[model samples]
Target: MAKSVENQVEQTKVLPQYVAALVANLLVASVGCAMSWTSPTLLKMDSGETDIPASSDEKSWIGSLTPLGAVFSPFLAGYTADRWGRKTTLIATACPVIVGWVLIACAEPARSIPLIYVGRIIHGLCLGVAFTVIPMYCGEIAEDKVRGALGSFLQIFVSLGSLSQYAVGPYVSYLVLTIFSATVPFLFAVTMWFIPESPYQHVMAGEEQKALEALQWLRGTSVEAVKEELAIIKENVREKMENKSTPRDLISTKASVTALYLSMGLLGLQIFTGIDAILFYCQDIFAASGGDLDSSVSTIIVGMVMLLASACTPFIVESLGRRILLLISAAGMAVSLALIGTFFHLLNNNSDTSSIGWLPVVSLVIYMIVFSIGFGPVPWAVMGELFAPNVKSMASSIATSFCWFLAFLVTNFFPTISKELGSDYAFWIFGIFAVVAFVSVFFLLPETKGKSLQEIQAILGG
Candidate 1:
């Protein structure tokens, strides 16, 4: 027993796949940085920090257009991931982001709102593609023992990048911030070249030897051990191909229907909870709360809380299970958001809000922490695990696209909601959704922790 435990530890210590997952997720971090760009930059622009001044409507366009790009980019990502392979697809996704950053760097100095808008749209396209491709790639490449942890890397790095941006963006000039953002993807593209392609992608492309080599490299195991894992991957791939699924087939089958429902529900949970809109306008939300603290500093602190919370999941997910974490997350989010709303409710009513000025900041920090624990990362982590190999790309693309569409709606309209309906009401609406998320996870979400893709499918009745 001791020897076996020791060997397992030894195996874990050398798992190359985890490293590969980390490297790929650097690009995801770049996406996170890009997504959070509006938070500080918008504030600067509104204050006339830039050469070109933007109106309220133009700022909305800059903030919301990324999801618009997300709405359309997933089809391209899905096609490319399967046809060209995962490594190439990730490398390709960087191009648009890099270009977007370059445009932003130029646009900042020129005060060119048009260039900035175009840059934001292009980055949004990259964001959409990254969301679609990286989860699938990470899910395919990781061994079952470490899959949960590695898959969660997507969110960890995302949170890290977000924190990095939040910490730095407020203090930097617009051109410097844009230039810094552009450097991340350039680094990601260069580093990713050293990692192997997903073995699953190679298998799907009928390159058995290449698949084996990838498996060998990823597993860092003996040939025989690698072969056994490869056989399982190939068999799963073969079975999925035999049942080859389409958009039509996904609905024709009970398994696929369940998978789609779960995917969509999880994606919906991620957005409707108001994280994207809140993050996009973090400084504004803080400013509106009438807090004594500097809104920029508070936003940075919230970003730090999010980063720390996300960092905890990979270690605990397999033990505590997905359903419980998600339930806990949703419930916590509901409470925090409600408290935040109450804070605003009292303040708006001209109640003595001075003593309770701390409430909004504390509540938001709790909200960010809870959200980071589950909704922020788990949905994307679980996405690639839910579908069979044949339909994974297609289903994920659809779900990601849908997720972004909801994001576009929420982000574009949030200011309107907060203004006309009151910020308290906007938060209350998100709390209501959080409560619904709790119920949904309790009844519908199956635990995929520590399970293989085939096993997960069987659990979902696929």
Candidate 2:
């Protein structure tokens, strides 16, 4: 049995393969569709096209409840990912969103608002799982040469999915949109079975034979190379797992504690930068900015910019490196948001002469462009790169839970801030956060570009 395993590991490898990354992103794309589905669906319901017209409070609840559900998903998904393997957990998570789409499809015809809320919550759970698992899977499967590109797919497909909703949702029947959305997760589940499981997961489970097979499929390398990589992975996994990793052990090790703090801090900064808030209220921002474009058209424009920028990231992440891209993105976002806030301040103060009426649109486009290139995609990419194998699930769960919790807070509270202190204050506050994010990247964030997962852990002092 040992000789047979050695012979299998000694087989020549294939290089530059992407089956794992491609399939994982397909699933991530489904979560993206779920995230943005509420935007146009709510718009349609508020327009009274549905059997039951939704009240404003109901609309808010529907929009906010997604993050609420996300708060619990990490626990379920983290355990499942660690226990069942990343591929199975991802396939399982897809079931909830598929069911969510069905409920959404039925709600309008049946005149049941409660059903739609339930659907949103279910979709939220899908988001939580996708955020946790896809990055981990991609990080594990990708070779260093292609790792940056693979990692970037998590955000790229998300942009594409959101763009799809902006483009298609407004034009289709609510039922038709729901049906279309349902197809993504269904397809994701079917396609994922073909991809290799994460080598890290196999190593952690002490299935060295399975790990070698998975690495052969993923790395496409010589048996020697496969064995070499497997040795490193095994050593890392054995060292970490030997301690019987627990929640307390997560903070006990310096590496574990650092990984936890870095992941949580990046996620926090990602939200506080206010891109999610901007996305959530794109139409209202445009309406209040006195732009000549229709709100829907302007919103689509925003989504397109985000999509294009995200598409560029996979091509550039390796060349620019994570820290540089993050720095550039953060500085640009800070300036763009500050300019946008200034535009709103001028408009609010009755000082915006007609000449610069284009400022808001210009600033917002710039903001989204910069955000997509760096902050939008990079944080999750980094999260996947950090953490030891034994503590990954627990650490990821804690970090992901923090992300969803803060997302809920920001999405829930931004409206109140806008109402009480004015939108200018909210934008300015986000701008400040952007500046702080830049400083954090410069002073604290470690560069993970072109490094192996084990290498990243080593750099973290694991």
- What TM-score number comes out for model 2? 0.85
| Per-residue lDDT of model 2, residues 161-246, tens digit only | 88878778778889888899899889988988887789889988878888988887776654455787798888867776675567
lDDT of 1 by residue, 300-354 (tens): 8999888888888777665677788789889999999999999889988889999
**Best candidate, lDDT-wise?**
1
Model 2, residue 14: C-alpha shift (Å): 6.3
| Cα-based TM-score, every candidate | 0.90, 0.85
Off by over 4 Å in 1: 1-15, 221-225, 381-390, 443-462
| lDDT, model 1, position 428 | 98
> Considering summed lDDT, which 10 consecutive residues are worst modelled in model 1?
5-14
Evaluated against the true structure, the overall lDDT of model 2 is: 0.80
